[model samples]
Target: MESFPHSSACDLTAEIGDYQQFPNPGAEHAATERTPKPKLRHVRVVLLSFGLLCVLQGILNVALRLAVREPTDAGGTEQSCPQGWLMFGSSCYYISSQRRSWDASRQDCVQRDADLVVINSTQEQAFLTGFTMAAWVGMTDREEEGTWIWVDGTRVDKDRLQWARGQPDGAFGGEDCGDLRTMIDFIGLNDFMCSARNQWICEKTFW
Candidate 1:
């Protein structure tokens, strides 16, 4: 006779139940793995952006330096001649075309905040001699002939005085007017009538 089925339907059901208990990955595992990938991508993007910004800033700095231009004397002190007159060394001189008496010439110089020419040194005397062709200077003895004095009240330095040969002998009744005379190989002095029209020289000290 045929033997009955050794395993019953209940036994098959028990086998299926055991299989279900075995380990199996689910939707939660898939989600956890996908989330980390996007986080890493975001970090990489931020790093790249920061590096690009730094590079751009460095380029701009170099370009700006190359494009700028500077003056040769930039940040240096300015230079200019003295005001209202030409400067020769430490002095200022005014050459005037208007003629005046010895006293009037002194007054004119005073009004201009200067003094009639006072030759204190040989260098100055020489420099002024070049300017004298027929100009009335500060030397005169209008107050008392034979005692010439400068408008600034300084006695004429006799050593520096370049009197012409046996000149200033008070020609024409002790002529008190002083004029600068120029001759060949010599710069000299000439006494003139104070009322004669001639240019004048005025000087002022500068510091």
Candidate 2:
């Protein structure tokens, strides 16, 4: 074999070692291919940030819904009455359909732990008037011929009494029991006979 000079061979060996240890441009490019591009890395970061924002928004919405909820009554609980009874300002009122004498109707109300309605306010009078049927109230003058009294042993207030036109005439017979009389113009009271059969209203208090 043809041999080079000692210095030249040493120089060639050094060059070969350098080529093996230090990579070329193509090898460097291949190494860089393993690293993620900047644009792609930025896109991944943006997507992660958006996902975190969505999760936070969902949590915030749930918290807002809980914050706006209506509060319940923390004081004494309210009570209710039986079916077919109406609730009006802590009182329960019931209008019966069955007809009975004034005394009999009053006894029925007493058995149910209530009494005949004694209207004290204009609102109550209006409400009672709404009922088309003429019903017996608690007002009566049976104890005295002219002194009106309620079933609760209270004197009747003259100002609060709604008397129909030409009432208390005691036409046909003497009228002692009071009733809600329906007339052409408006609803008012009329003295009715104690033995007359009529529907009645009962009232009681609730919590």
Candidate No. with top TM-score: 2
Model 1 off-target regions past 4 Å? 1-84
* lDDT by residue for model 1 (15-104), tens: 334445544577768887777777798999999999999999999999996654222233464333345665555567887777777667
Global Cα lDDT for candidate 2: 0.81
Query: Candidate 2 on 67-149: residue-level lDDT in tens?
Result: 64333334755466778987665677889989999999999999989999888877777777857458999999887887889
Clashes of each: 0, 0
Superposed Cα deviation of residue 53, candidate 2 (Å):
28
Q: What is the C-alpha local distance difference test score of each model?
A: 0.71, 0.81
Superposition error at 66 for model 1 (Å)? 32
